[model samples]
Target: MALPIPTTLDEITADWLTSALRQSEVISEKTTVLARTVEVLGVGEGFAAELARMHLSYKNGSGPATVIAKIPTSVEDNRNGSELLGVYERELRIYERILGEIEVSTPRLYYGDIEVNPDAASQLERIRKMERLPIWLLRLILWFLIRFNKGKTFPSVLIMEDLSPAEAGDQVQGCDLDRAGEALEAVALLHAATWGDRCPQERYWLVSSAVAPRLFHAGALGARRGFLKNFGRLLSDHTRELYESTRTDNIERTIRLHREVPQCMLHGDFRLDNMFFARDGGFRALIDWQLSSFGPAVSDIAYFICGSIDPGVSEAEIDALLARYHRALESAGVSDYPLEDLHAHYTEQLLLLLARMASVDLLDLGDQDGRGADLVSVWIERLDARMARASSGR
Candidate 1:
């Protein structure tokens, strides 16, 4: 059995650092970290965990001076909900099991692990044992207190190289023209690397939203309703109607269309916030693998384009971007997939993409400024284009 996920910095001791360092091959078995100080980094967009920069002055001088640590957030609801969904472990497994196999650039992972919770229901049991009172009253009080806890026993943590020293792209302002192209190529290369590879999809960690049939319609409908409630004020009447028309069970539609060709792993979320760029206009890495799984690879492209490129970038220009992506995929050894097919997949995934941008909780996105407005405006613009194509019956 593995230890439960560490929820606080206190649990990540110097001994744990030395062990993890040895495992990551950062230092030899003879080296040891005599002391370490953890500095919590400022929270970034959609931060589901604590981001810390560790200052490690090693006695043997064989380890890094700085590294980033990822642990579950102190916010109980966020922690518990993400825990229930196994997103934390999903990321850890990617670093542990997938990164080494792929050609895509990501920050070097140092140490990561997840374990089952032992005292899982101890909190609830303890609350029940609280002093005698009316059962209903006691229950309600306990609920409020327990709500601050992750509720379940899933504990997980990850530590990797600090990308803070590198350039972190902003999701709100989005990436620039050159940056967007580099980002797209990075995506294409990654998809090509795992194209038609069945092992990843077969992994127990893979969670394909499109294949999760049990919750498709209910989730889609909820997503539709959520979009309307959260973003209606930000949309135009015609654009809103255009979005409403295509809000059908997107997940089901995606699965149907995606199966037409070989499916590969997708960056379920490929927005700018998860991107890091080199000063020379290349994608340094794609981070946040919590949503990495199998799907129509074009979903990653569409998601990136929607929020990345400037709103002024035309559909034709985006078509060129797709062409660039297709060529990159080919150069990466993925052959015979036509640019036409990529375009079609990109167009088809637009509806689900629309429903998603419209319905997902606005706050969860952490994009509420000028860039967010542009993202919605541009997304609806694409929706309008989709309507025109449908009207022409093309």
Candidate 2:
């Protein structure tokens, strides 16, 4: 099936939603849309797409509640995949049939369909005219487009329970050894519950085969190369050696490790932004399952540790977080694996991380304050040091 060309926000309207929801029987005339806000969160340079979030308030018979709407920029900005309605249709099927059954915390999906918002039409036109503008200028224009699109018509939009980022912000500030541990524990539980001997590998393989190629082709290699070039200067001599070693390894070893390693359901994107913290000081949910797949357990662990933890965090703190993760894994019935084996697995996976990390735009130093860069450097350095120590002993 061909990919659906994405629709613009201006293309979405309330009538479209009303009609779609009527088919689903979730909302009716008694249901009123209170407020609507459009937010362009980020843009994907790799896919040349944008990530947007829509905040909507709706009143059912009793009162009012909020919902979140996500519309990929490619659909809205590029109009590339509209022809393939099945893209989102299949995603909805996965969410309802497979992901919904899993233990992982995800936002409640209400309805998803394709339509256009009239309010967005004018702004999107203006944005299109300003195509030659600098990125910062374009971003400003998009932000304005979001503000202008608010309270206008909503077309077909993917709706889910609205989650606030405030609590998550608080969690980052309050981050300590314990909170880090809880997050890792959550990851372990998610992995353990989703995949095991009891689960059908065919189901996951179906999704993986469909998705992995796109990811690899869609700037995965380019991203890795970009990250290395931009940040290679930060790596110590030891870290550089490990980076060089991975280049010498053949694809056979990479593929063998991927196949032989214990497989588990993966939260393909486990970065901090995708996770939500509850008001009561625990994980509320994990969002953005678009990249969910089956892969090595260490993939998720390495991504989280290297991507989320602040660089300012001491090595001692990192060690503690690692311990907490192991404890969490043990509690989840994943105790058979040795710590040394787990670390080695994580080390071997670093090359993959190095490859993928560079392609995407990381949270700015303002957002992560060199934390992500620091973690990556530290991992490289530690691996290099360990390899050297081993060689000396040999």
Candidate 3:
């Protein structure tokens, strides 16, 4: 039987480590974990999950000396929110079915699992029972339950080969041109490998390729309201006008319009914080696959640039980096996608990004020592500058 999934750091024990390692075939059956020290990692850098470094001593001096263990957030609201979006299942599915098949750089997964909440299962049944009722009634009940947040939680556990000593990039600090180039290269490799593939199309449940209008519309409205309250002073007239134009329907339309372009698997949440850089100034790996999806690959490009590029980066520099990304894609054998098309799509991606600004409000930033808010503040400044330049035809 599979080991019980741990919800908190305290539940990660030596016995559990031994069973999990053996189950994943990472260690021999004879190997036993004698002791382990857990160090919580990325304390406030992540919102959906919690991570820790497990330093282990084996009875036979075999198996990995250290590994990274990931678990669902202990916060009830975040846990339930994650479950509602199926992000836990999506991450596990990507690790199991997609990552190995692609050329992208990501941490090596040792073992991954998500335990369905029995209470959630029961609640699901209750929702199912109402299916026989009128369609309107069902919709009303679901909307009400979702609005108030019902009892839903999916506890997940993922253990992976630790890639420490590699530093995580700072979103608030942004990145230099060299790091930006490396990030684009990594994204190109991913998009090129999955370009126009049927993996996501066939395994629909494994990827969130399609946009959910209801969920997005609701979130966007709230996000927009909160963003205006917190960062309205930072917006220039042009940017504020631009932000005001990204109504819920317009945002959806912008995203949906890109459907005509080639699609690929995207690290839906591509940003500096999600990437690790080697000490020698090389990209190590990308983490946080909860938002993995298939979409116009350039969307990831725009997301990365908007969040990571230094706010003062010149337009020419940004263009050069994008050109480099295009060349990398071509080098990987992607054809028929031209530089002009990439640029055009990138502009649209920026507008969609403006709509996405509100999303910052959804994050739990209470424990982030204001770093999260500061990150968003800087990110908007970058977006505002970029959008202004775009408007002036620069």
Candidate 4:
């Protein structure tokens, strides 16, 4: 018998919770969840799902009070992208299947499923969904490129043990040096465990080898248009000039560099908001596995340090952070990857990350007031400073 992905909070029964947990050995076979109060968890950043924290009442004394459920997003516009990119599919698979084979701290999976469909959705998913194709020949060519797709549109839902006991690092305020160090440790362990782990690569549904590779390619086509739109508000005249001069060439080079680095397990979206810290100063879990991939070590490292640099992190200090990551990697038995090579990779990742972050056409920092706006400003501030320093040959 196949299980269905629960689409809403009301659908999750105490019996289902008991069955799932008992299977995972989180609870004894005799133990069971009796009731639960579902509190929808964090929002304002990740748009893929409505995260609900379930406060449970158990029949037995040993069971936990809370578990987290990731359901489909409330935002209609974002749903298409989430589904098309298989975001939920990736996260669910990681928890239910892949994470068990790796040594990383993530929410313990209670239940997960990518719903099955017998439809031929993937055959024409790309070309058939094309909007206003003027040329028949071009449309036909695209349709012909992708041969056969048995892929169905599946709703990937995941339920995991709640980590609400820990504090999620703030992406807006950014992590300080100490928190950043903890994040590097979390990332190093993730990479080290799966540096050459063949488990993920064997899965056919997990084809995206890097985080949002399609977006990177599409964004490249429209880079100038989007960057120019948000340029005036985010940059000084000098920094803007500097950004304009090297931006295109750098993105071109770095995208290539990003693809060419040694492949390993990556927590693709390793930002502050996605990380939780225990009160004892230990990193708890890395959430939002939508972007998990086999890519460069610096892919995750660069992504984390870039967003988590408090208010003012000097370039030298940023370089030192990369060094800290290298040391941790070596501690985890990763040998021969020198700090100098890591530094070069970090620089390229930072450049590519900045260009992509700033190059989105729809990022109106004004629409989102408060912390959202503040995070954008901080990102742009860091971007401007870095570009300016590079231009000055500092």
Better of 2 and 3 by TM-score: 3
Q: Where does model 4 exceed 4 Å of error?
A: 13-32, 60-62, 116-153, 196-202, 208-215, 220-232, 242-255, 258-260, 359-367, 370-374, 388-394
Candidate 3 matches the true fold with a TM-score of 0.89
The regions of model 2 sitting more than 4 angstroms off are 1-6, 32-35, 39-64, 75-91, 114-157, 169-175, 203-229, 312-316, 361-394
Instruction: State the local distance difference test value for candidate 4.
Output: 0.66
Best by TM-score: 3
Superposed by TM-score, candidate 4 places the C-alpha of residue 141 at a distance from the truth, in angstroms, of: 13
Q: Give lDDT per model, in order.
A: 0.67, 0.52, 0.77, 0.66
Over the full model, what C-alpha lDDT does candidate 1 score relative to the true structure? 0.67
Worst 10 residues of 4 by lDDT: 142-151
lDDT of 2 at 334: 74
Give the per-residue lDDT digits (tens) of candidate 3, residues 185-298.
988888899888643663433443444434454465655666788788888899888777776355355546456688888888899999999998899999888988878887
Task: After the best TM-score superposition of candidate 4, give how far the Cα of residue 208 lies from its true spot, in angstroms.
Answer: 5.3
Residue 139 of model 3, lDDT score = 43
Best of the two (1, 3) by TM-score:
3
Estimate, for each residue in 333-390, the C-alpha lDDT of model 4 and write its tens digit. 7885778888767666655665566434433233546554566667666566555444
Clashes (N, CA, C under 3 Å) per candidate: 4, 29, 0, 0
Summarize candidate 2's per-residue lDDT along 1-394 as a digit string, tens digits. 2123236664445555544445555677577555556675533211222345555556664221445556653433122222111233334445667676667677777766543333332533343355445544544443344334333222234667667653542213334556667778888887777555734364421243223322232333333455567666656576565555544342333465467676777776676666777777887777665555666788887667665555566655665666777777777777566777676676566655654444443223222344444444554443333343222322
| TM per candidate | 0.80, 0.67, 0.89, 0.81
